[model samples]
Target: MAQGENGSIHENTGERSPAGQEAAQDTSLAPRRRKPWFLLVALVLVAAIVVLIARKPKDTQSSATAGPQIATIKAATAHLGDIGYYVDALGTVTPVATVNLYSQVNGTVTDVHYTEGQMVHRGDPLIDIDPRPYEAQLEEAEGTLQHDRSVLAQAEMDLARYEKAVTLQAIAQQTYDDQKLAVEQYRGTVRNDIGQVQAAQVQLSYCHLTSPINGRIGLRLIDRGNTVFSGASNPLVIITQLQPVTVVFDVAEDNLGQVRDQILHRKALPVDAFDRSQETKLASGKLLTLDNQIDTSTGTVRFRAQFDNNDLTLYPNQFVNARLLVKTLKNAVLVPSAAVQRNGTQAFVYVVTGNTVKIQAVTELTTEGDVSAVTGIDAGTVVPVTGFDKLQSGSTVTIQSMQAFDSGQQRLERTQDKSGSTL
Candidate 1:
């Protein structure tokens, strides 16, 4: 054992101790080894963090210097116009008069004068029955009437003679009175015969059937040589008037008062008839009359309108849609119906005032199609018609497309109409 330079005791033997060898190895290896890069990496990171923090404030200040973003939207203007109030109802086209021709006398049909579905005038001969039977009966009645008239003349001559005889007192008064009474009885028989002759003539005329009115005749029911009886259950033919046609429609009882007032004032309400789809207009007419009572089951009243169907556009029992122009609104303020938004039953519009839009509550009078007649805003007020997604009470909007809003509202009604969740 030997003393080392410091105070530690070390063995100086050729085979050194394990602790001494480890200490010498550490001292020699300390200078030759590489230095760590951790400190340099840590300083570079600190500089990068400082640069990021310094740039973030400048970007934030620039964003804060700029004003709020203004949104782009579409807008429309309100205008004044005349809006018509119309009532629509399903209807059926009907003829004013339909005549069903039946046989009045029993006879074999001799001739059919009119063709099937032909237009016939009043008094036009239509069918002919076997008149020989009725003609012979009429002749027999006339012969009997002539014979009774001759007997009455002879009795009257005899009564004159009897009157002269009674005045002169040449014959008994009882005998003259008997002759006068016989002459009076013959006169009564002659008067009865005259009535019989007139009745027989009427029976003969019935054999020739004539059209009672001018109209389009239907198909023939009975052919020639067919025997027809009197008072048939079915008609021989039907004739319907086509020139003046009518349409029957039902109106709701709730609207009865408005309709009744217009009718009582003698105002002819114009009615337009459309096809089954209620698209193509078939004809135009005026309201003729209405039923005195309403139908209790349907809560509606029947109304009839008459049209001059010169083109034969209207037919009996044809289905149609009738629209009646009840009244007209004059100088009504109107806007696009889309502009009107509803929150439940409350209707509102976004009225643009200068750069910002304010929520404006409005009263909707009526809506016809795409336009609405509103009361809250003025006629020239501007409103945003689209872009309701981000709209609020005070939304700044840029109008991209401005339109002249026309008035015609329908679905969005007189009450509250047309709503959305986005307001």
Candidate 2:
């Protein structure tokens, strides 16, 4: 029985050892069950890829969806009417009628009918000379004229009587002849007295000085108490007509033929006068006349333009810039001056094509204000105005709506306001 118990114990111990050994084997295999370095590395790489994908630049994919980055202008058809070829020149404003007021007779100035710088009409009395002496002279002239008239009547009657006496021989022939001679002498004397009287009367009428033309009187050189004389070198006052004024300017000889042709064809050429600043237009007028001949020394021609100065804004001797409209052109192509780009003396423009910009050479004809007349660029072509500094031929542009572009930002804001207002 003891031997049996020993065998049972050995079996039990062996069973326990097998179970423990199995547990030990399981524990050792647990360390060996860990994943390989390559598998871990693959899992880490997959995780890194996912994170990188999530952190990638979002704008890159949506960049193409962003609208064009260029500013554009819609080309419109325009009727180019009367494109004038103008000649620019300097000019001076002058009065159409200028006169120097003077006294016609020697006398003391008694009354001044007009104030300084006063507007006077034609035949208006401006200066009234002392009339007392003139009145006495007129009275004396009248009496002398009356006496001459009575003497002339008596001489005619005597001549008729002498002719009758000579024909009838009622008196001595010598006596009749002497009587006729006496009548002739009396007639000559009477005619002389009449002329003297008329002269005196004309001298009396010259006491009053009147305006020769309708004009504005300048400052009076002679006061009311001053003495003035007829045919004096200096005038009593100077007067100028400001209502109808004249502007005189010079044009080159080359343009003379054009001006003359325009005058003959159109009857009148249009002229515009601007002040010194060239910003303010003073008046518009028609070409009235030209000098008889061109100035040989300067190879230029002088011209005069007449303006109706109803407003009286133009003053005499004021300098001005003048433009003469010689002719006009029709169906002209014009673009903004800013759209033209210059490379040396060659002129070019940026034209918008399908997904690209092109640089095209153009011929510039003339410029008026901010617009230029050009050829080669059609009216429908889109010419760049603002981005010329950053643009080149064939450059891709993000075409932005001109209405939506902000010049300050040089960009277009895409977001609408919270109020749903389009910016």
Tens digit per residue, CA lDDT, model 1, 1-423:
234533342334556778989999999987666344666788899999999999999999999887656878899989888776778889999988899988889999999998888989999998898889888988998999899889989988988988898899988999888888988898898888888889888988999989998889887788998999998899887999887899999999988899889988989998878788765567778999999998999999999999888778889899999988788788999888899999999999999999898998999987766787889999889999888987887878899999764454233132123221110
lDDT, residue 342, model 2: 93
Task: Give the TM-score of each candidate.
Answer: 0.73, 0.70
The local distance difference test score of model 2 is 0.75
- Best of the candidates, lDDT: 1
lDDT scores of the candidates, listed in order: 0.84, 0.75
Error of 1 at 257 (Å): 1.5
Off by over 4 Å in 2: 1-82, 172-185, 230-232, 341-348, 355-363, 391-423
Q: After superposition, how far is residue 239 of candidate 1 from its true place, in Å?
A: 0.8
| Over 4 Å off, model 1 | 1-74, 337-348, 355-359, 367-371, 384-398, 404-423
